[model samples]
Target: MSDIFRYIQKYQNRSLKELPFTHVDALIFAQLSYIDYRTIRNIYAKPKLKQIAHLLDLQEVEAGYLSGKDNRRLLLALAHAKRYQNIQLINETKIINEETCEQFHALTFAYKQMYYIVFEGTDTSILGWKEDLHMLVYPVVPAQQDGVRYLEQMLKHPFKKAIVVGHSKGGSIATYASLHVNKKVQRKIKAIYNFDGPALQSVESLEPIQNRYYKFVTQATFFGLFFENEENYRIVKSNERWLLQHNLYTWMIEDTNFIYLDQLDSRFYQINRKARDALLSLTHQERETFIVSLSEIFDDNQITDVAQLTNSWSQTSIMLLRSLTKVEKEKRDAIMKTVGLVVSEMLRR
Candidate 1:
């Protein structure tokens, strides 16, 4: 009914005769919703297509690939196949290698077909419009990495020109991959779009990554407030839509979706200042010592509460305190005291 919807329908419906049958459900269910994130992630991680088929209520035959062992590969293959003849899509590569790029590039332009197949008569997928523009999003489940291993995987995916997009953690991964991607591939990226993803702690150091990204946030979304530094970042604006709320349930979308802004809350600034000050007090060596101590606590083998008492605090503290000449507990107490001070100052601010 709206101009954007009309445009999306035209684009989706064009070359229908050439389109593969597998794509019908995805097209019909193409609207973005918060629910899609976990579903798609599980679908990608599971190895058997039959399992996914069961979940989606589609026959195993309908899933693009017979094997579910590699959901990332299957979904990515579908992404590649679903677009027009020339567009290519690839998903999930933690480490870039020659083989990874080739697979991604090979699967390019598969968008005319279905990447995912739905079970018969099961219509759980929800679709919505932003302004007049219709968006198709399948939220991927959150993945936590020690650092940038996931970024490396995406970077390895080969593409001559592409638009990289994601929500939350996916958005952060998109940002990391865009910055550290191979020089050749980096040049090929057309755009980087992130929807309310948390910023990396070290974002300030990533000048190359920062310049090309477009970040969207809902006014008063707690996410925007949790980051280390957003002074260099940009925000995408939207009108007051319910889905546009931080929770995504408040998204107000039509043909021309609007993104709105709320002034950054004072509470967030106060919290940020407290955190920054506390972190600044610790030297790099002290930080490492603290982390090692925490790691030991997690790795210790204590059977029961009673048995755990037998474990030697002396040994743990010795190793921990060895990292610094200062007494381990004393240092910890100081840090806690500093934290309390930080919190008090924040409240005062």
Candidate 2:
């Protein structure tokens, strides 16, 4: 089956005027937001597509977060595409704060009097994963606040319409911002596409934006189904198996659209959902301790991402143990209870 890279090749010469922007195009830009554009140019000035495209050939593909995938190739295609050449990328931000345990990145494509906001999924940081965990208990995470602020500011501009798109964690954030933005701003959103994004804790939260929202997930989705929300997400066929389906590059596309599936591959989701549900059961105070303990452990090791910590597991483990000892006496019981849940999950799995 074809994928998005092929879709880019098929549509490169077509203009948005000739063929209006489709949901597929939104997905393409959403995926592109993950690029570390700073590696190529200082884009505080909001560069056009041509500028970004010109630098793609020199970009180290492996250095990209979408390593071993067609993201770079697809980006190159987007750069060359007549449809996207007129687009300007703006409001780009990548912030990682150890104190807040926040990892956020977003880019907005401004064109045709519209704002196409793309919230990037998580990077390979343990902290990013922790932020995703924050969604389990947090009514609002730091990144979500940033997303809403960004949305509000952008909407105030002359753009008459908007589309919000995101993958993974960004998808959830995109949904959150779309839901919370004022009624005036919400009316301007043309559509909200979430590609295999995790669910917000309550599906009812989407009531404000339901008519404008769409969610697509791979058949063997775990990330999309991670939290306990009855979101009415559609299923798409994937070329890969199990957790690997989370990779957008593997999602099968045909003629500019995803190959829709009748149902999900629930085998992988069930056991994992149980583990996630258990974690989400933590009391609000326990959840706070959980976040703090993790932040302290990783912060003390002087590391940010998973790659750094994994490279020195022994030292990291030592640091974590030392941090655990400093936890308040009351928190120890909660931590121990969490450990028990994890142990029980392992045995069940």
Candidate 3:
């Protein structure tokens, strides 16, 4: 919990909001900070609804609402969509059709672009509650279905080569899409970079498509590198401490853009297999209960409430470390850990 406060204060200029932080607020704020600023502006400025939809592949809303919300949800939605653009070209081409050439040229001019998209919910709401709810609707299902849908629809550009990348759940979708796109599309992809997204539920279903994915995780990252079947992708070591392991930090920059730790080997994929087996042993009901419990913490008055609720790693961690001695460990930990963090940070402020 203290880690969250330290991050907020250390990056105050990067902080999007000034009020006291809550559990959800901390998470959303960290996410926004990780993103690059120009990408955020492009999401809002892009006039085409389909273009906006393609830019934000995670959340699904009808194209008609592109101009309606003028709020953070729409803004965050756009920000998420823009993270996947990694198109690169060696030679300038006027040979392609004008529209296609224009699209290719747009991404070719940049090695990597940073974006910051934020959605500050109404005071009555916590940060990212609506967005997180949307992600959970298909809990326990393989993400490839949606992943393929997103890739096919959004990544229609034809260029010499491109690298697609993302963090957390974004990584999951990127891996799924690259492995499953048609062979022609697959060849166009030079590489894929995923930062500690969770593994798939059924490896047998994914065996055919696993070779193309490149995954990175810290030694201590609890969620992405582990869970479901352990990640079977290339895993990278990070210099940051365990608590700051997720994508908000750790990924370094090379030639101005982010540099993914370049290590993918046979051992990494094997670990992902082990992780999958361990996660499958848990019952389906057990998983649903866990999400429900995490959601309850967000039902708090603001996103930062979790910081004030407890002084520990998280409800999920307490359950695992304590051997789940009690049935209610997850819920109790969520409330307590959140409260502890938020209160301490408020006092410090």
The best candidate by TM-score is 2
lDDT of 3 by residue, 1-349 (tens): 2332233334434322333322222233323322122343344543222233345433332231221222234344423332222211211111112211111011111223311111111111223223232233443222344445444544455543445554565555566666677777666655555566655433445544445455556555545755445445544445464434553434333321233445433443454444444433444555445455544444542334334334443553543434323335554454445445434433453
Runs of candidate 1 exceeding 4 Å displacement: 1-160, 166-169, 196-211, 217-227, 232-258, 301-349
Task: List RMSD in Å for every model shown.
Answer: 13.8, 4.3, 14.4
Best by lDDT: 2
- Best-to-worst order by lDDT is 2, 3, 1
lDDT of 1 by residue, 1-349 (tens): 2322333344453443555322122222221211122344355543232233234423332342212223333333333332332322223222212211111010111232222111111011110011000100111112223113333443354543444554544455456556656666666655565555556545346656556666666543434434546654434333333122343223333433433345544554454455445544565666645544443443453222212322554453444344344425655555455445544543453
Candidate 1: worst-modelled 10 consecutive residues by lDDT: 127-136
> Can you list the residue pairs that collide in candidate 2?
none
List where candidate 2 sits over 4 angstroms from the true fold: 39-44, 308-349
Q: lDDT scores for all predictions?
A: 0.37, 0.75, 0.39
Q: Candidate 2 vs candidate 3: which has greater lDDT?
A: 2
Judge candidate 2 against the unseen true structure and give its global Cα lDDT, from 0 to 1: 0.75
Q: Which model is ahead, 2 or 3, in terms of TM-score?
A: 2
lDDT of 2 by residue, 1-349 (tens): 6888788788888888787877678778777877777755463467778777676444475465555246666666777878777788866778898668789998878887888889999888787977876786777789988888878888886647899999999998898889888888888898998888877776556777888799988887878877747557889888987666778778887886778988776765665555565556566776666667767676665666767864654565455445456455555544455445444543463
RMSD of 2: 4.3
Residue 85 of model 1, lDDT score: 28
